[model samples]
Target: MKAFVFPGQGSQFVGMGKDLYETSPLAKELFDKADAILGFKITEIMFAGTDEQLKETKVTQPAVFLHSVISALCMGEAFEPSMVAGHSLGEFSALVASGALSFEDGLRLVAARANAMQKACEANPGTMAAIIGLSDEHVEEICKEVSVGGKVVIPANYNCPGQLVISGDVEAVDAACEKLKEAGAKRALPLKVGGAFHSPLMQPAQEELQEAIEKTGFNTPKCPVYQNVDAKPHTDPTEIKQNLIAQLTSSVRWTASVQHMIADGADDFTECGPGKALQGMIGRIDRNVALHGIA
Candidate 1:
């Protein structure tokens, strides 16, 4: 069976979907629709914006979603999958691709999510860091030791073997990074993010997004979507909605999700997004599985 995966943030670039926009009429039509729905020329920013401009949470989220979903649409009859999964914000794109959500609805959700997250960030300053060459347990222990007196920190993204991202208050994250390095991590590099995602700091964002999510309509998906919150495949609309609502404060179990997919008979994995980060992570998770990329 084949599994289609979508990448989240940090997968975007300046000229992400320009080629597709210029080449395919279908892609252009979708891009135009996105611009109208977003109330601005997002296509202009996506095609010619600077790195800093595209890095804004609002632009980054929907820009990546558009590139991924439109790329899948451009695949036409070839874009078939036994199952689908996405990392963080990419979940919206996966839902649309799997027929669980309409394209316009997905874009609107992404935009709302991004704006809410940004607001949460501005309200409470925080950050994230990447820990390489450390066991997940070891990193978790370090985070626990460093987090105290409301300085909340926790493991955020389990990217692959020996690679995990931690998120929390800026001081707590920095202290955790130091301890993780002392615990024999190869590198504890801080990420360029505005706030601590997938941690308690995002509770405000979660609360804000919950209303939008509940208001949006979700149809039965064509295939099961392995959600980010629990790394479990969910087909029911209610279950999907619940998982999505909880995902803002839950660790993204990418490694476990890929393992579950492989165990469930996903032999061929195709990454549908701007960057090849998911492909690389899946490769490291299981070398025996075949890998392909759409963008």
Candidate 2:
């Protein structure tokens, strides 16, 4: 079976999706629609903007989503997937690709999510760090140990074997990194991010985005979407919505999600997004599967 995946925030770059926009009429139309719907010339920013401009949360989220979903859509008959999954913001892309959400609705939701997350970051400052060459249990235990007295940190993204990302308050995250390094982790590198995503600090963003999500309609997707919250495949609309609502504050179980897809007979994996991060993670997760990229 074929499993199509989408990448998250850090996958974006300058001139992303410009090639498709110029080469495919459908992609151009969609890009135009995105610009109008976003109330800005997002296409110009995506096509010719500088790195700093594209790094804005609002632009990065939507730009990556557009590149990912449009790439899959432009594939026409070749974009078939028995199952799909995405990392963080890319979940919206996967939802749109699998027919669970309309293109316009997906874009609107991504915009809303980006704004909400940005506000949450401003309201409560925090950050994330990457812990490499450590067991997940060791990192989790260290996070739990350091998180105390209103300082919250947790294992956020389980990227692949021996690699995990943790998110939380700045002080708590710093303390956790110290402990993780002392616990024999090969490297504990802090990520350059505005806030702690997929952690308790995003509770405000979760609450705010929930209203928008509940109000939006979701159709049953063409294929099951392995969600990030629990790394489980969901096909029901209500369940999918609920998972999405919870996703902002839950861990992104990417490693488990890929494992489940392979266990379920997904030997072919295609990453539909701007960067090759997901492909690299999937390759580390299991080297036997064939991997491809569309970006």
Candidate 3:
């Protein structure tokens, strides 16, 4: 069996969709439709604008979605997945690729989600950090101890065996990083992210997104999707909705998701997104795992 995975943020770059836009008529029509739907020529920013322009949360989320989904669309009948999963924002793309959401609806929902998250970030200032070479339990305990007085610091991304990302308020994250390093973490480094995603800080964003998610239509998927919140394959639409809601505030169990896929007979894991980040993480989680990229 083959599993198709999609990357989240931090995979996008300038000139991301230039090749598709210039070569494939299907890609061109979709890009043009996206520009009309978004009410702006995002293609301009994606193809020619500066990194600063592409980095806006509102733009980055939808832009990455477009790149991944359009690439998958252009794959014609060659793209098939026994199981599907995505990291963070990539879940929306995965849902579309798996036939759970229509392309138009997916793009609209991604735009709404991005705007909501950005607004939440502006309302509450926070950040995230990467802690390398620390056990998951050790990192969780340290974060819990450091997040005293209603401040925030929690494990956000379980990327691979010894690599975890923490998210919370600026001060809490900094303190946790210091303590993690003191506790023998190889490196406790702050990420260049704008806010603390997948933490309590995103509660406001979750509340805002709830309405849109409920309003959007969901259908039976073409294949089971291993959702981020639970790291399990789900076929029911209700379960998918609940998981997506929880995903905004829960840690991404990517390591566990990959393990589940492998256990279920997945042989080829193809990453359908911009970067090879997922491939690298999957490789580290299980050296026997094979990976392919669709970039």
Candidate 4:
């Protein structure tokens, strides 16, 4: 029972895939193909660009995806998964690794998703915040209360116990942070993200990406993928496509997904991505489960 997990967004760094590029010719070929597909030298930015440059939404998403998918590919026969799951943008990586989507199509969709999300952010200025030391119920209730009179705020990521991220309008999120802190939260910290992803504010991005997703072809996956939107295992291409499209404006149920995986016999989790963030979260979710990281 091994589950291969992929990380998203914040997992990226300046020199993320340089070691893979330098060590494996297969990795180099994929990196070169990525540059051509993206119409730019993304590998250069990933290996030597400034942190500020890597932080750009368009660069961050695809860079992380490339690292994750390429790492899994380089594993060759060793990269077997009973189940797969990803956090946010990493879902695209999971699909590619599991054979649900081709490498080229996954990269294209990820680039499209990033550009669409960036456009949505510019069109509607919003933000996200981390709420620590609060129960999920309390956070959800407070978010609902704060989301009134056109203010749209909601829980976005259920990372682990006592840790959740909320996203929405800037003012609403700030206000929610204050209220959450006042309600005995250990820390209510704002995240340095481009916009309120996984919230109603991303509806425009969802609409824009839906077309790209529907147009892309999907195949039956080699293994089940635990989708972000529903925290459920999906093998059907049609269902996976629908869930991926909904993920743009839906919460990432990481906690539930991990729990479900564990209950369904996922005794080990290998994080194949730029950072060990998913490993840490999976550790928090269940200490008994074995955890490993490829990057």
Report lDDT per candidate: 0.95, 0.96, 0.93, 0.96
Question: Candidate 1 on 1-295: residue-level lDDT in tens?
Answer: 9999999999999999999999999999999999999999999999998999999888999999999999998999999999999999989999999999999999999999999999999998999999999898999888999989989899999999999999999999999988888889999999989999999999999999999999999998999999998898999999999999999999999999999999999999999989999999998899999999997
Which candidate wins on lDDT? 2
**Candidate 3 clashes between residue pairs 3 or more apart in a chain or in different chains:** none
lDDT of 4 at 70: 97
Q: lDDT order of candidates, best first? A: 2, 4, 1, 3
Query: Model 2: which ten-residue window has the lowest total lDDT?
Result: 10-19
List where candidate 1 sits over 4 angstroms from the true fold. none
TM-score, cand. 4: 0.99
- Which residue ranges in model 4 land beyond 4 Å of their true spot? none
Give per-residue CA lDDT, model 3, range 82-160, as digits (tens).
9999999889999999999999999999999899899989998899999999899999999999999989899999999
What's the number of clashes in each of the models? 0, 0, 0, 0
**lDDT, model 3, position 32:** 99
Candidate 2 structure quality by residue, lDDT tens digits, 1-295: 9999999999888889999999999999999999999999999999999999999999999999999999999999999999999999999999999999999999999999999999999999999999999999999898989999999999999999999999999999999999898999999999999999999999999999999999999999999999999899999999999999999999999999999999999999999989899999999999999999998
- RMSD of every prediction: 0.7, 0.5, 0.7, 0.6
Clashing pairs in 2: none
